[model samples]
Target: MPSSPALLRLDPTACGLPRRSLLLAPLGALAGGCTPGAPALQGGWVGTHPERGHRLRGELPRTDGPLKKAGVLIVGAGIAGLACARELARRGIDDIALLDLEDEAGGNSRAHALGGSLCPLGAHYLPLPGPEAHEVNELLHALGLAREQFGRTVWDERHLCHSPQERLFIDGPEGGYWHEGVLPPPDGAVALAQYRHFSALVAQAQRELGFAMPTQRARWTAGHAALDAQTFAAWLGAQALTDPQLRWYLDYCCRDDFGAGADTVSAWAGLHYFASRHGFHAPGDEAGEREPVLTWPEGNGWLSQRLAAPLRERIHTGRVVMRVTEGRTGVELMAWNEAAGAPERWQARAVVMATPLFIAHRLLASPPDALRAAAGHLRYAPWLTANLLLREPLLTRPGAPPAWDNVRYGATALGYVDARHQTLDPMPRPPLLTAYRALPTAARGELLSGSWQHWAQSVIGDLAATHPDLPGKVERIDLCRFGHAMSMPVPGLRGSAALAALNAARGRVVFAHADLAGYSVFEEAYTAGVAAAARLSL
Candidate 1:
């Protein structure tokens, strides 16, 4: 396990986790290294050891140890990697090993601690799985989060996101006020009219052009292709739905899930956000309801930890894949062991490149056209999650009380999630707010170059409006940055022929990652891993 910041040494009471949970809660955080970009700050980076990942672009470290052998070697150890291993095991293929660059598994869906509280460092929340996501549905059932009762799906109420699920702080003449939901209030008659039109459009989309969560589940037609060929913003413009508030809300939704707003992502992605999960709803509509999500203080890290627990002995961390070579006999992988400070080699009959498509492209000795093209067309979004420990609750505004998901209107940042919102205890001690910001591709440089203090201050300032005294209440702030957080489903990327080819590829090395899906989501990544494992000849 990586050493977390010493700021959380106050006591366990500050954390909402119970005593038994304190013992049983699986926590694996990435270690931080001093960088040229570093200076003295109260908080530091906690995710994606940037140094280790960036090392791939530089020179080599020669191998020193004897070659390690395995029946199968799976790289990544993320949600996809872990799922691959689990599926392979279920098939009675036990002779396998998993490796990751970071000291811990869970890639983007990892956990960290702040002021004794377990908080999400990256991706959080798992929405209710749709019918076509059989793999995910099974996993939820196995984990006791959901079950089929009398031919109807039933969830464990405890795991479902508590009511008052989300809210948006809308700017007004009176500063800003909290709205019950992330959607804008549709302030004017024109906006309201546009809202109803959009709602009907969503219904039309569901009826005429079907949408599904896993995407693979839905049938791809000319209608889907047309939507994929243009940007969401372009599509919106063509519809004559030029309402500012509606556009802002649409942009916010795009940024939240796909990492880019309407101008960047394809039209299919924007519509899929609402149409696939639940149709767009205006206030007073009979179907107006929020989608239930499963969350904990540590977010999806809760699920990741459980997925990783069963295979602890077989998992290896801090092993950066140097090169991958496939031969007539088997596959050869050279990995650099970070902790041991030595190079190691692995000989495996089968290898799964369960990493981002770009990373896999860099690793392979001879890459296929499909893999190369897929990697070439892809663009990853830079993500930043800052977990701030609050000494006390923030001052609440009118409307709904505090919510699990809090967003600020017209803000570039996605806003923050209250880590303690789901706590069963009525007593208050301290709470951690996990603030998320998905930056544009251009800002990747600044994200990597900026000091932890600079970014921490920026995050605090961004949220300061919602809580005027936030600066005073915060005890510590720990920020995590991912350079290639997720693949943005830009126009034409989803229906690209190259992705189809890569998904169909079979041999000694099988590719698996969210990148293969042209977008990042738990369902896509998890299913991709399982599919990859199934393709294994073993």
Candidate 2:
């Protein structure tokens, strides 16, 4: 592995600037002291519209604008909010208004067009939904991505991730790279045995209690719930699975899904990562077979666009919802319209807060004790994603062909995914590589304090380990910083009273978001939105 560039350290107090100023700082300022003639950052920064979110910290200006009335008001036009709107429309409820802070409605699932390819800025793939994931299954079927076959759900083959799905670049290996699957090369008998043993355990859990997505459908027995009390690392220790290769592979899985490692995530979540997939099969495969994942160039952003397409006029983008208050007649909401530069009040019979718990806590007026407790207990992981527009495929050692998902062992990043892998046409000359990195162990303060250029350099440096010539082949690197990317399923949090409290509807205000399910998977977000809509009907 190549060594990383020297880390750049910054002091906000010394610079006499607020932490947020770093996020908006010019790349040139971050590149200060760089060697003359060094490669300058080619692309600008893009993100989840942090400015609108930052406004939440300050009080909004009261407006004299006329009140707008609606039967239902959905806040935060992410997957959860869009799902709520879709469900409401399906029930013939068109008096619904969906509001979002960003110009786009996908939230973290947002994607950007690079050349002719669409690359994801956040979420990139969706696992095949199990039978228990009714909402997800229904959504897929509606989207024409799946079909029922012989009592099981079968995903369309074209959308399924192509073969040679994954590859790992291992350090110190004979060839330094291993092709095919996420499992490490079988160099040692003990390591191979440990890997099989762990797989057996996951298979057993799936057979007995069935790890269902959205987590709500999973059988939550006392024995299963007890896994939430300890870290996944501790569980592995108890099981005596101490192979370094196995540990690295498991850690990669945790980071890929939860943005945290085994030491940080709850054991139950770790187990769920492996066992939650059920009742999905390939087009011609029988039941219980491992189903191929469904993906597009834009990832779940494609799904989000489909969900929001029918309700474009009803969905209001660039609107920050400031507050929600309960009244005798209905729920009243105060939102700041960025374009109009004024606060607008809206009254609705019911409101679905399809946002993160932290934002919901800030927006709710006089929330109940349970809601407050739930908000306090929740924690989020920060993430950084960079879409590197390469002139050609990345330079690689002779091994397997470029897989859809590429990973490197002993690296900080989870590796890059080929955005054009799903394209029916031949791969473009300048392929887009969507790189991902999660700051699982870093403090939120640290993540917020870093400049965009700092993150870009970090990503480039990490990628240099495998593709040393990556900096030269890159056309532009679009960086995105997610301060509160996804909710962390820490020990003792998943099945706790706090999560349950957060999921429950308070009066006419129904809470929704992937965080409610303690995992930020597509199924969780979809389920939360559908459930929130159902609650409004009740």
Candidate 3:
């Protein structure tokens, strides 16, 4: 579908900028002509390597080279792959090789450099690990980001999100005002009651129906399965929690974490968003506190980088895994080495497919019934992240001070995070802003279609709703696209019996990706990886 001009504030008379052909359509179909103005926008896709992986869709050339051998082989170098390798190393399994399609590891957790600053390309933060996410806690403790002080786990203060943590741009009588947090404040008596009511509901969900990070650890009950059967919007409607502001914030949160809205994701996912980690907080709740998250300028890429550091010697990048065949002797893997432009064969006693379920479907010579069922039940969201290099500071709106995470009311995009927020330097020299937009399942075709310019313009237009002067201040903009970004936790996905069987599979070719958990997150990926490695009898 051709996109109409989206979120662009048109003012051709003021700046002489063209407006007609703004957001969508590329082949001159609905739109094909327009000069990008104000400041020359220079950017192309970064991080994700679709071209390399897309080769698997065609008839792959047979392997013609000498065989490479590893005691244990991992097919991805993302968090899961890396964690699996580390776990294998811990288990005294030293012969390991990780083949990745991208030139760099980190998958969606990758980062990009823009001008003098480093900004995130995908996932931006990690909330403090909960009790069940022991692997993540162990990783943090090993990284020195957290430590035991007086028998209590204390996180490094420098790594936590700085004060003025979040702000929401809301329309007001005078003009638009920035609220102190992402949640909308009570506008009236009814809204206040609704806010408190939602908070209580989240508490009830947490208390009765348990939720946990790496969600698989949570005890799934009939109540949870009932919630998992319907969309979050329907559940909210049943509760009669229909305040527009409250809905907008809830939808925003769904988009932020799950890459979709409440209407699309399951009710279980919606409540789990609040219940799993931090319970919802009303305005005046004394027990309320903003959940602290570990973040860096480069976001979770920081963690990925450290995870990849020690395993650098074992990791092979730019290798497009084409086929995986299991014979009576061992597992044979064929990969197209993108750099060499040749196909190579490798054999291992055991293989860990740390890639997504869909990719695993493509790679396996004969995918099992469980893998087929799991892939069939899952759907993925296409994500776009743009890093804007600004020449000057953005004009502030009224209300709260500038914060790290800045969001607009009823925005199509999730929001922008200031890269300079964590900086120790007090001097203000205009910082880079990383904007995130999670597109709908319908938009996956448009997102994958080559048009970084149009997508960049769309993101700029999305931000223009709040920062009108942003288009002029942007020095450079680089966009990153993830075609099958994160698995959308639609109704029935979280409760799929196939996932349970797949997760517990102890086989020669092990599946270890976020898809086993029905969605993508650091904890799930890491835990899946560690668990997969543990199941490997090699």
Candidate 4:
């Protein structure tokens, strides 16, 4: 077994800059690489390859009695499995099969439509990758969106989102948007500036090569990976970054990415959140528009539907895999076929466990030591997304520009995004905006088992605090709570030896999950899917 890059620490000074850092000031900017295009509304890239629906080897043989066989059997039809399928199919392998407990292909990125508007069940946005992401660019062009500017003002095509994106509802008044224009209190102003400074510093480090190591083991950097082996709390204290400004930034970042705040996450994992985004745009430099995200009337399910188009007939829904055993001859999967109420078996050359870590911990037989270690290290947080249908558009303080995402300062969780934002023209009725709650790990058991009415009332009450008239304007309230909506990069989890082990594939079983990547973002999912495919192909 090779030493994982997670454990490496080379000389940072040799790369230039300061002694503690690697590479001096980027050697005069290196031409700023390729410019990324504006973010599009499309999924960015979907089925662009020549072998969009190509399969590997042959379809799994249908059996009258019980068992079936294939070259590679992938579990979970999420992005990871689909990416693997696409890669393998392109390589002239057509005998692969994929299965998932859910009927769709995208795991968390799935969406559903309500009242003619599509709302997200899990993920919605995919940020622009760095300029060096050639493969992503290729995929985008192939998807027919290479030149399209998403979210651009159709009339002018020169501006984007009209500037101010997000505004905060604070102390009975709007505290302005996240950047300029919105007015914040003195402390808020100070905190926001400091936060920006810190973000800029982190971005600088990320732009450099030493800290941006992509390989499995640590690269030519001096900083110890073990330094990240502590909770964000410990790391912050050690670095003396406990000022209110720094704290607020960390708290907001944690909430946005992991659905938890700083104290709940690992410092290393938190750093990974900022360091990993390397999105790119073309025909221009950093001044170009962001890569637009593709969305369905049902949110990301639009992309899922496209990816699953070719494999729709081959999919077997409700097949809950109970366990997997790797025998001398082949791998056998023991599953409870939910549709027929019978236990079924499957044999294949390779298997992809695309399910969440929590599920994988119990389903695979004699799991590799790394997987066991990861199972023990990984922790997931539950979520509650409350969708409220309003009879009237709740009025806010005048001059407070209405945007998609609305947040409340010092709230229980981040606020909600108007699911109807994508629809430009006016509508006869007010649509639903989903209020998402990142319930603390300590509150999971109670929240999950609570009554629906109880949860709905609580959510309404919370929203009412900000929009006093919102409750009365609401016509219908629909509640959807996911017990394990996301994975938390718990403090000390990132640099742990166990994590490195779990990330490593054992024999024919390849592991892929948002949790394994440290950051739970859409791009990470895409990268994970692509990485899993490359590994399997090798």
Most lDDT-accurate candidate: 3
Give each prediction's root-mean-square deviation over alpha carbons. Answer: 9.5, 6.8, 4.9, 15.8
Mark the regions of model 1 whose C-alpha exceeds 4 Å error after superposition.
1-41
- Model 3: clashing residue pairs? none
User: Per-residue lDDT for 1-538 in model 3, tens only?
Assistant: 1111122222221123333332332322211113243435566788887777779879979769768999889999988999999889988888999999999988889778988778999999999999999999999999999999899999899999999899887754444677778877666778879989999999999999899998988999999999999999999999999988889889988888888999999999999998999899988899667888999999989989999998999999999999999888789999988888888999999999999998998899999898999889888999989998887887776778989999987777888999889888778778789999899888888988858877777877667656656666767788998888999899999999889988998978898998888888899999999999988766
User: Which has the greatest TM-score?
Assistant: 3
Estimate, for each residue in 148-184, the C-alpha lDDT of model 4 and write its tens digit: 4584322222212322345655442231122212222
lDDT of each: 0.83, 0.77, 0.85, 0.57
lDDT of 2 by residue, 487-522 (tens): 888887788887777676555788889988877888
**Model 2's TM-score against the true structure:** 0.89
Off by over 4 Å in 3: 1-39
lDDT of 2: 0.77
Q: Which ten residues in a row have the lowest lDDT in candidate 3?
A: 1-10
Colliding pairs, model 1: none
Write down the TM-score for model 4.
Answer: 0.75
